[model samples]
Target: MPNRYLGRRIGKYRVTRLLGTGACSWVYEAVDQDLEIPVALKILRPEFAGQEQAETRFRREAATAARLRHPNIVYVRDVGQVDGTAFVAMELHPLTLGRRLALVGSLPETECVRLGIGIAAALAVAHASRVIHRDIKPDNILLSQSGDAVVADFGLARALPSGSFPSDTNTVEGTPHYFSPEQARGRELDHRSDLYSLGATLYRAATGRLPFEGDDWYTIARAHVETPPSSPRAHAPALTPQFEALLLRLLAKDPADRVPSAVALVDALAALPSAPAHAATLPRLGSRTVEAFRPQVPGRFHRLLTAAVFGLVAVLAGWMAWGRTSSGSSAAPSPRPTSIDSTGNPTARGGAASGSGIPLASSGPPRDSTRDTTRHRPIPAPVRRVRLDLSAPDSAQLYVDNRLVAVGRWRGEVPFAPRLTVRAVVPDAPATCHTALHDTVLTRVTPGQRLVIDLPVRGCAVVRYRVEPRDARVSFLSLDGGNTLETRADSAVSFSLPTGRYLMRISAPRCITFSDTIVVRTSGNASPLPRKLFCS
Candidate 1:
């Protein structure tokens, strides 16, 4: 990822802040300094930009996407190299289908079907051009301010020759939730694969959940390959039989069994009754056409906060009421003593004096002769949160058990793990203190314990970074912080770091990564270690 690109120009586009990140590139909202208009720019990662296969695919994305002219497709404006990085500029939508889904976990059946038809129309145009979008997740779909759905991001599109299977095999592309069984197997794919992915997306839109839920990606991928998806109706019981039938047919493992083409899929959606009191009319991907368009995702924070406030109020009220009763009773001077007897019951001190001048029984029920001996119950220990406050050299990063949990002075409940290892490192330069820009300390901390590590620096080192292939993507991983960009092979990147032993890992795509202990000297700026890393 680029550390700083704002105010930089790639052709006519001037970079601003990041819009969002994706698997292939980092997208930024930019302004065309020439046209004085806003546009979205996607910069290819250095690793993917240099590889021959990746570059060819990137070029195909630009060319194939540019060939299309449709209302439902994101229009590509320009594509070129900018400052050693490859980028594509496209019309800015400002909103995405993913963001909409985040707000609306699910959609009404009619709304879902309408969206499906709109997307299918776009896919029909792409498939007609012999291009198959390998990645068709909801994030790739953009929404105009008017709510019209526009399919975007053709970065993974594959061009197919007439009447032939593409040579790509043993390559799996697409989101895990939408991957077809054939894709999970790394088999050749055609336009039909996009239909299956569309079905998966539709399933989520209708049910608010994926067909398969797993703890991790590997398990989900395995389920996609080995297990049949749960019936969509299982999650969305309101779905009509006709709707469920078409969805199941689209999701069939065999491509031949799916809808013949995107055109057919659109036709099927159009055939369904889109307007009726029972069927519920849903405007086809139009602007938030009606005020009834409400998000399905429920916000829990407000409700929880209200409940906690009420709970605290109730507890305080009860405690105050109890104190008032105790005070009133004390003033009245009850005959019974406040002290408890051996049986754990309140008894009178003066031979259990009572109002009638006769010894009275205990306040509660009488003890049974057959009752067992009373055993003292040890008080239960209360579970409490252990606060963490860590300290290191200024800009030092911290990690617990290989997971970067804190930086600088951080306070948090101790992580739940046996033999917690607390490590600290200071980066030669401060980017993010979440990773290992410096060395580390492996201290074993027990769960439910607090600790403060004042890590002292041994002293500073002026180290220079040199990588080959000026365009080759490289990054310095801080054991104490998150990943940050390093100086390109052309730029002589050097930093004055706190003197301490540190482990810095340098990695690039299409090349083996180099990892080792780099010790900085205790005295003044040490001689530049003549170590040059090469990507081979």
Candidate 2:
């Protein structure tokens, strides 16, 4: 069905434009006529609306999300059913962090830290209320105009249950790349699972890359269960050792090894010196504090004078000098030391002297020697030629400073003779593209110098299959007796198998046994397989 954005108004909100669509719902930028505010309206997909169980789950999500009133959490304004369609009204943000990250390649260290802290703070609030945000990823984080971060998509979140799964059955309800080891193995999940997802999101934000990458969903999901993540510091060496340590702790296979709560993680982050806005422009350690300097009078005089006498004299002289300099040269340097002091502030004596001197006269008359040396001078031209080569495993859409320049396929070259920003994005995984401005004066791109860029696809194939009766469970058994694969109820039985053969089996109480020997080729479609049967 073509996406219909008609006169579907939920509660007092009037649907305007279609923002986006997900598997189960369609989101619209709508106006709340009663409240006279813009809100995001999420309506259940038409097919899912008829399912009572799905509707119940949707209602529960709204209730849980509505209870969370955090600065970093997207506010849910209203929830109701209109003309048999279930919809929710929520605070609307301009864009998602995922889109921004895609546009900029990767966020600066300071921005990543700030966003991470905000997300952690929001998660802490949810955890306090016994809610677990099972789906935590870059796409779920929204960015406000002021750069504040807010967590969205609480529809998949669930209240903490009292019991744990004993068998190979669990509801896998998160993006594969960000899923925790426990979540991948169909085991019990807690706040730690969310922490793992946060770490994955932070890893991408810091490095412009995902911790685990593969051609399909199973491969990436299995990496979460079996493979160790590449160090974030390896990709972005400028990241602090403390943050690297935090990433490792969050990615620990054992849930107990991770931070106990989101609040604790936030506290730990708050304790660390905030990541600098620009790596090249980091401030000195003591740059913000005022230094206490003792007056350096002739040694015996300094010791003999009382503290009150010295302080009073220094303050009076400082005020008189400050007034004199304030009206002096417009070109004179401000009354601040060029270098930081031991206490992180400028030395009082040095700072007081900067603006005290008379402005130096220009060295001789302003030179007009250009007229005398015109014959020897070289005229500079505006245009500069720069060779640009774009190469990737597959096709890429190339952009120069946000403007689409060309679309390249396979390993090829594009000679961009003009000095401009160059960015390449795979249409599917726009987030993985590399974006950089070419300044010929600062840097030169030579011919035969290939710029190799990797365009990350979703990196995993999500094969979703529903086992009938709700109670029936599925598992992938290796005919070679290697490892048993647990399956999630809401998700397909996934495994990171290469182009090879494997045996799968399904089991449940009083159900006919099911097993199959299937050859999974790399180039085949990603759709879920038809239900298979096994002899009891």
Predicted model with the maximum lDDT: 1
Indicate the worst ten consecutive residues by lDDT in candidate 2.
285-294
Summed backbone clashes in each candidate are 14, 7
Give the per-residue lDDT of model 1 (tens digit) for 401-486. Answer: 43455556666775354444555654333222222333334345455776665654322446665555444443444443423335
Of candidate 1, the 10-residue stretch with the lowest lDDT total is 285-294
Model 2, runs deviating above 4 Å: 1-3, 6-11, 161-169, 275-536
Model 1: residues with Cα > 4 Å off, grouped in runs? 47-49, 165-167, 215-218, 275-536
Model 1: lDDT of residue 235:
85
* Candidate 2 lDDT over residue span 47-72, tens digit each: 89789888887887788878877778
TM-score per candidate? 0.52, 0.53
| Candidate 2 local Cα displacement, residue 350, angstroms | 27
